[model samples]
Structure formats: structure tokens, C-alpha cells
Target: MATRTQILIPIGIAAIIIGAAGLISIPKDAKLEQTKFPMGIVKIDGVTLQVQIADTRPLQTRGLMFQEKMPYDQGMLFVFDGEAIRSMWMLNMQFALDVIWFDANGNVVYIQKDAQPCKSAIETATCTFTNGNNAKYVLEVTSGFVDMYDITENSKLEIISI
Candidate 1:
């Protein structure tokens, strides 16, 4: 007969495997909260953008992926629980876009202009992943979004989340 430890070890392993699978399995069309956070909008020369806060790990990991298109005045605001370096890839993105990284204080830490969509498994200038390891928030928008609105480093992002 198998020892008690041996039997329990297999059960424990199975439990961990199941939990891991659940954590990694986020639906492509997961319907997260659609409510908008109440905060001052940042207008780059009066071009307004509606930002939706993604303050959870599941939401952050899904960062604009599998979206067919983004509305002209709409964008996603990825919020982290704490300050940590983060990076973004253009994998599964269907359109050319831009990513603006922000710090915990909502200051623009970095920006990648016109990030091209990845059409294949290979990385290219337009399709490659950009690292914003110093960023806390990653804002995804259409190509030429920043220049079109004249947004720059000094721009501030208002956060109304506690």
C-alpha cells in the first residue's frame, strides 16, 4: 500500500495544477466592469480620451489584446496594485497603435509611438514588443495618438481610484 504522504502528495499536486490552470485561463471576451472612473480627463489640446481603469491582474494581462478596433475617443487604462516595472507586446493586436506608460503618480514615464500590429510570430519594428519596465500603467490607443493630440512627457493622468 502507498504511504499517506505519497497519496497526499499526488492530490496536492493535482490541486495546484488545477488552480494554476484557472488563473491563466482568462476569457478573450471577459466582461469586466464597464463603469468609468470619475477623474479629470487629460485633453491634449482638447482632444478627449475616455480611459477605462484595469486595476486587477487579470485585466492588466489582457491589456487591449484581441480587440478588433478601438473607438476614436476611447482607451484602456491599466492600473497596477503596486509600483512595478511592466512591459507590453503587440501580440494579437489587430491595428497599429501607441502605448503610453505612466508612473504611480500618474506621470508619463514613457511612450511608444505607432506600435505596429504583429501579423505573425516574428518581431518587427511595428510588430515588436516594447518594454516599459519603469511603468506602472500602460495606455493603449491608436497610432499617432500622442502627436495628433500634442501630448507630451509633461502630461499628467488623473486617477480617481483609491
Candidate 2:
């Protein structure tokens, strides 16, 4: 029979090995900086939202993809050079969203609520696209946000910062 000391020694070594393996298996992106994107504050009616600014093409292209979920008070804002027709897709998204399009003067041009994610390859290939006309900015938030906040086409966006 193994002595208690010998048994405990092996068990502790095994535990350490398992812990190291688990840490190693964690994705590198999991440790990415929380402040990777520039932050801004926006308001609709009287409600406020803290948003990640996606002003660059690369940032806009990667908007909200691969993320697990967004906080209720947080969103992503896409900024464009000028007001025009804008389009968005939901490929590789992990959750549904509510998208709002705002024109240059902060007027809500259009709204797309509860846009579903496309997780699989087939879904990605056939993903639905949401578009709005004369939109200079696009804001994406968690699903049901429009109804919760009573956001409408007439709602105006107060861009506190960008």
C-alpha cells in the first residue's frame, strides 16, 4: 500500500499539471485589452449608453463579432465619413442585436431590431443584411434594447462624445 505522504504527493502533482493544461488551453484573445476600442457616450431620449467607437474600416468590419454578449448599458457605434446608405451583416456573431441608424444631424434614420446572429458556415453564407439610407452613424446594442428604451424612427441620438 502507498504511504499517505506518497499518495498526496502524486495527487498534488497531478492537480498542478491539470491546472497548467487548463490555463494553456485558454484562447489568447481571451486576454485582449478591455479598452481596445475607443469609448463614447450616446443618449436616446433620456437613456444613456456607453459605446465602443468603430471609426476605422478594420474596426467596423470586426464590429461585435465573436463576442459572447454585450452589457445592457453598452453598445458599438460605427462612424462614417458622410451620410449615405449603409449596410451591415451578422456573420460570426454570438448574440442578437438591435441596430439603429442615425443621420448626420443625429436623427434616427432607421432601426433594425432583434437581428439574429449567423453562427454556422451555412448561416454565414446566407446571412441577412440590414441597411439604412442617409445614415452617418450606426449603433448596435443588445437585443430588445429598442423596445426597452422605446427607441423609434423619430428618436434623436445625442452624441456626447466620439
Candidate 3:
């Protein structure tokens, strides 16, 4: 009942629509691999930091794990699809960090300053820190970032780009 041209055109349009939607829908907990993910930037009151984005499964799971050293003002930002009571740990971590959580509106909701690193996954699991609040983003910066910037709860965040 339909010509080849007519039938193929609708199929092509449907495919494009579905593809675009897929690209727009990244889950909050989805931890994508780092190699394919792009870098982004975050700004605190007057300080800007170069940030690595971890939006998919593998990247989130391996976030800053076993890393050697993070230069000043450099960090990793984890983006989840939705906000929840998120928890983090220092598993296989090489150094301490200040784990900061941001709400959907980019306000600092919780912070775990001076989070100590653990030698093994088993040990780190027992030392998990949770915000007890909903957070769509989590940033891991050098151990003293919080104190250096004087960042605190309800501090505003600026996400430059992703």
C-alpha cells in the first residue's frame, strides 16, 4: 500500500528521532568509560577548576581510583541522572580528597572533607560517606579544596560546560 520512498522516509525519521533522544538521556548513575567522555569545568565562588567528567558506569566506578596525584585545582565530577542519597568511598585511592555533593540546582548540599584513602576495596566499603540528601553531582578534589576555598553547605556551583 506504500511506495518504497514513502516507507523508507518514515523509518529514517524515526531512527533519527530515537538516536537523538538516546544521546539526551544519560542516567545519573550511569558510569561511562572515561576514554569516550568529554571534560568539563566547575567554578567555586571565585576559583575555577579543570574537571574530568564521569557520566557512565565504568568511569564512575573507577573514579580517581588508584590515581597517583591530583594537581591543584583539578578534580573529577560525577554526574548521575537523578538525585538520591549518594555515598562515596576511598577504595584503591592513592590520596585523600574532599568529596563534595551538589544538588540539581548546583548548590553544595553535603561535604566530606579530608576523606582518607583506603588500601583495599574491602576496607573502603566500610568507610563510605553519605550526604543523607539528594545530589545530582559529586566532585572529588584535592584533600584541602574545601578549606582552601572556604566552601560550605549551600555554596553555589557553576557548571561551565560539559
What is the full ranking by lDDT, best candidate first?
2, 3, 1
User: Model 1 misses residue 140 by how many Å?
Assistant: 0.9
User: Each candidate's TM vs. the true structure?
Assistant: 0.64, 0.75, 0.75
Model 1, span 93-159: residue lDDT tens: 6888878888877788788888887664333233545564577777778887888777788877765
Which regions of candidate 3 deviate over 4 angstroms?
A: 1-37
RMSD of each: 10.1, 13.6, 15.2
Model 3 scores what on Cα lDDT? 0.78
Q: Cα lDDT of model 2 overall?
A: 0.81
lDDT tens readout by residue for model 2, 48-146 = 999999897767766787788998899999999998898876856789999999999999988999888865433442355556478999999999999
lDDT of each: 0.66, 0.81, 0.78
Q: List pairs with backbone clashes in candidate 2.
A: none
The Cα error of candidate 1 at residue 5, in Å, is: 51
Show pairs that collide, candidate 3: 27-81, 28-80, 28-81, 30-56, 31-56, 31-57, 31-58, 32-56, 32-57
- True-structure lDDT of candidate 1: 0.66
Backbone clash pairs in model 3 (N, Cα, C under 3 Å; residues 3+ apart or in different chains), count: 9
